[model samples]
Target: MDSSVSSLIRTSYLEQPSAEQAVHPSVYSKRKRLIDIAGALVGLGITAILTVPIAIAMQFDSPGPIFYSQVRCGLRGKPFRIWKFRSMVVDADQKKHLVRNQAQGHIFKNENDPRITRVGRFLRRTSLDELPQFWNVLMGEMSLVGTRPPTPDEVQKYDSHHFERLKVKPGMTGEWQAKGRSNVKDFEDIVRMDIDYQRQWSILYDLYLIFRTIAVVFAGQGAY
Candidate 1:
């Protein structure tokens, strides 16, 4: 985490109201698991069918491992490896500091990020890179719908209020993605949406978001 962001989190923590109510316990429920399991099974089947073609494309586009895994903060800040298709050059992380961030947050985002390979760009835009995360969902590390998972570094930069977003499991797709994902330049907006989802959570809402995500993915709206 950046020193500046660390300082901000500290300052925000100090300023946060102490009387804020705890996140609803119902956000974590057995019904959510059923949804996750069903979604993951279907998603894994799709992943199985697409794996070979995606692998070949990624290999020809750039030589590296086909899959990428990184530690991401899950429910209540638990660390777990989040899987995805490799969508950048092998040295992408090393080169991250070379480019300016287009998104306004601790997280990095650049629509025209130079480190993205040709095949990777298509995968990212289509959200095909995120396919492997269904395995994470199947394994109980993630849910099919919840808040976007943050990197540990990003979580380290979070304010006290921001921790509320992690009250439920991290997700493959969420309210943020169903809303304008790339169009959301401000991280605070993402946090607000997350908190809202946590507060208003229901199986029906999750289903709605899943269907909405399918529409968003098909339209390729607000995607990099």
Candidate 2:
């Protein structure tokens, strides 16, 4: 509920399509939900298999909780707690201002962030840190493929057009993740990609992005 995001939402209301037009058809929405549920069920199984080892490594590498959760803006700019594996020091947020962000705009990114632990770096590189988000997807707070959710602080800085990305549920992997995620330094670029996904969304497109995500995760391209 930042002033800037609120203003953006009001402005977007005037310029964007009506709710009926903006929303996907019922059939498409239902199919997407089914896909999300199926994907999350499978992903949770993998998460269960990896949780023990990952937890042990995280504890040994950095003393903190095994899971990390933060408030993120989701569909229609609603706030939700997005979950992930703890890939950084427990005080990462407290010390965030101590380091400089390499990325442009409100989004923070530091390729060589000191807050990241040894095991954390590997988790980030392989995107294993995002495994816990499958629960979010299964819980209907997120989608399997959609725009990456933004932090409340980041959303506070958004312009009118940037709010368009919040039309759909946020995703664990999306067009940004499928493309050069780390290389995208500008927050505008991320917004553009998210908006693009929204405009061009289809079940097949989502599947394609999901497959692309697997390849990107395996290759570890453009990941810090």
Residues 80-142, candidate 1, lDDT per residue (tens digit)? Answer: 789999999998999999988988876788878999999998998899999999999999989
* Location of the lowest summed lDDT over 10 successive residues in candidate 1: 14-23
Q: Estimate TM-scores for all models.
A: 0.89, 0.90
C-alpha displacement of 138 in model 1, angstroms?
Answer: 0.8
**Steric clash pairs (candidate 2):** none
Shift in Å, residue 30, candidate 2: 0.8
Task: Give the backbone clash total of model 1.
Answer: 0
lDDT of each residue in 162-208, candidate 2, tens digit only = 76777788899899999977889898899889878877788899999
TM-score of predicted structure 1: 0.89
Q: Tell me the spans in candidate 2 whose CA falls farther than 4 Å from its real position.
A: 1-28
